[model samples]
Target: MKGIQSTGPALLMLAILILAPAFAEPAPNTIKIVCTTSVLMDPATYIGGDRVEAITIADPTLCPHLQGDIIPSRIQLNMDFIPGADLFMAYNDSNDQRYNIPAVNDFMKANNYGSVTWKTVSDPSREWNTPAKAKLLAEEVRGWLVQYDPINESYYDERYGEYVKSFDAIEPTPAEKEKLNQTQVIVMLWQREPVEEWLGMNVVNIFAPEFALNGTRTAAKVVDDINANPEKYRNVSFIIENMQSGELAKGIEESLKDKGINVKRVVFTNFPRSIEGVDTMAEVLEHNKQIVL
Candidate 1:
């Protein structure tokens, strides 16, 4: 009888232990933030740490303007996080106002959810792919996190410093810069900032979508330019393409190949998850750098 009683209590305690995790609630004061994209979500997560739950609307690969049907579907999928989201974050760019914000607003209104705070973390017009811009972005995220949760200001500051250090760690060495300066590249307009400005590569030319510059700078046009003046781009060893912008360089590659000019084509992405195992902005920088190096 004594053994039975002792074992019964032990078994009951074991059951409780097993079930505890399933029933546990999130820590008190853990604010939930819903961001427009991974660019914003990544920093919010790093700075906020355990004090905030950050979720994003679009996959890192898809830009806000191209989200189309993805917007409503993502809102529905993240309904659990939406209801309790304390803040709605975005870059306040035209795309967010046109696509992400309107769709999110409609969902909340239709569902009769209460208003959530909205914050624009950075200027949307600035290119954020470069290390300098990424550091600025991390600082902005830390500022917002401290404002949102003053109790954890010290923790947020520490995380922000660590995030900045990651960018510093990946900066190109002087020797790498010297080599990059000598390597000539033809790149996509969207990727030129990092390839030309950040990496210090000599960009011979740039190509963009048909809509950009009224089709004057399309890939077809680049092919024509290469054909018309082969010597101008003769030294170009790499053709860098933006993953989001589609394969605009295929025609360029073929044209160059036919002219007996061979160049390596490398695709770069501005967002995380666009490349497997690249989950943060710093990783994105290093990933793109390794491609050219």
Candidate 2:
């Protein structure tokens, strides 16, 4: 009788414990990533697919590289947002968004918030914004996921392979040869050689601030860039303002216009987003293609 009584009670307890989880809500397995620059937003999404949720803090409408002192509003980016992430990455190349990095790293050190420590990782290389660079970003994202969630490596690899294949299939319009009305090149506040190659344009340049603040590029070394008398400087057809730095682009256009070079103007976003309904990394490139052509 005593054995039966004890055994029955134990069995009841095991049943309750086993059934408890079924009644309780299951935790979600999706990864959460926060990217500081708009440039990184689409790449994370393209590589992560359904497995990830990414938020970008930077704007596609303004310069991502604004000096902290020059832009007071940007210093207020909420640090609290970093704690909820599975991964946090900020672009260190171009304007690199360096001012925001310290705040993120400090929050990580204090909270140890995510699975990985975010050091000052930057790509000064031209690959950061172009589709050609996206393949590399996808590979990196897969490696990070596999390292942290080994069970999902196959899943991650499968998706990434699909992503890379599409990039391989892309056929940008062939390089333009004639430099008739001064050839056109995409301007990035500076040269983005990759974007130039992607657009098949002949030249690209970034605006030096001395022109904006001091009222002209004539005193600036950019003077040589405008002097088409030299063959190397001839093909700069227009100014394609980086999304973040359109103000700079407008100012540069005016400055250049003042100097007799009438450059065509277009705006380019650094990443994919809601604009023109573009939601995919590949679509982002396609959007640029449409814009450049």
Evaluate all candidate structures by whole-model CA lDDT and list the values in order: 0.87, 0.60
Q: What clash count goes with each model? A: 0, 6
Candidate 2 positional error at 109, Å: 6.1
Evaluate model 1: give its TM-score.
0.88
Runs with alpha carbons beyond 4 Å of true place in candidate 1: 1-27
The residue-by-residue lDDT of candidate 1 on 126-192, one tens digit each, is 8789999988888887888878788778899998999889999999999999999999999999899
In model 1, what is the error at residue 122, expressed in angstroms?
A: 4.2
Off by over 4 Å in 2: 1-28, 67-81, 94-97, 107-116, 119-126, 174-183, 189-191, 204-206, 211-237, 249-263, 274-276
CA RMSD per model (angstroms): 5.1, 7.0
Worst 10 residues of 2 by lDDT: 173-182
| CA lDDT, candidate 2, residue 156 | 76
